[model samples]
Target: MPLRQTIARYFSDHAETNDSHTDPLLQTHYYKITADKGVTILESLFRNDPLYDIHASSSDRGEISATITERKKAFIVATVTMVKPLQTAIDFSVTTESFLRFDLGFSHKVIQRLYAHTDKELPLVKNIEQQPAHR
Candidate 1:
């Protein structure tokens, strides 16, 4: 057997699983932006990354799904939801294609990088007014 296959067989949690693992690595993040803008920004981010290829997107639904092939073949899905006027939530799911059961924290690293990039790219608000007390 090949070196990679031998190592994978030794390190893998379960060998019975199929070649491509179906489990998803998931993470959710909150940001200060409207859902619409968040969708646009995320889409742009994914498209700009050479490692990723956007396969499906719905601006109206604030969802984007893409394939990433760098160190490993993976699928990424992101969803943006509006929690308040100035608050939004983004969720990411990464599924890697590998014989090994674990990705060695690769998915987490991807999420961290994405969050850092998004945070840096988002515009900062300069002013904010406190809400008035209810009468």
Candidate 2:
């Protein structure tokens, strides 16, 4: 199966639950990633500033969610829903490097530009509180 197809299937089979505390539907077995690089890249390309609130699942099928609060607004803006396999992370390291090499050789500046913007937005992302802290 293709990577995108597999990701879609994982989300389809999962159950979604509402999290009143964070005000987002929590899907079981997901990993939330709010990297600054990803945020900046999305905003520049999509014209949408990302808050990096992603609800995702891990390879083990454990449910999780994320919320990235905006500096001005005390709420999340970017909500992502998907599932990524553990193996993909490893594959990405090599594949991404290769892709970058190819792009650089061909003088394709798009990737460089995208990554630069993503770097700007990355510092704003922070993980959402998942557990109740004891006083």
Candidate 3:
């Protein structure tokens, strides 16, 4: 990890999944599922969890936003996109309520946990590992 990222992990209150993120765990995840199904699965997960209080969701846009009201306070948004018929992408953004914009990487941890939960409910299409190398 770079110095700046390490600093941000401990000193910042926000974290998000991006295509270019250095950490693969923090990168966008693809699964073999439809966008609507992905949205339903995630919404169900959040609704079932007592810690999560779902506030808004749009199946057409494939977005589900929720807030964590127990143990800590944090807002999270999960975006699902259909790249193809059965290929879907999921990404997360989390911001925690803390003083001095400090959550000790709480936002990052929350995203990781959410991903883990979602992963259990779907099959993730592995990224490019089996492709033949070309010179």
**Best model number under lDDT:** 3
Pairwise lDDT winner, candidates 2 and 3: 3
Compared with the true structure, what per-residue lDDT tens digits does model 3 show for residues 1-135?
Answer: 889888878898899997678877798888999999999999999989999999999999999999999887999999999988898989999999887778998998998999899899999886555347889
- Each model's backbone clash number: 0, 10, 0
lDDT of each: 0.67, 0.29, 0.90
Model 1 CA lDDT for position 43: 86
Candidate 1 residue lDDT tens string, 49-102: 899999999988888988786877777777788777877777676666778666
TM-score of each: 0.69, 0.21, 0.93
Off by over 4 Å in 3: 129-135
Candidate 1, position 61, lDDT: 89
Error of 1 at 18 (Å): 27
Candidates in descending TM-score order: 3, 1, 2
What's every prediction's RMSD, in angstroms?
Answer: 10.7, 17.1, 1.8
Better of 1 and 3 by TM-score: 3
- Model 3: weakest 10-residue lDDT segment is 124-133
Best by TM-score: 3
Candidate 1 — which pairs collide?
Answer: none
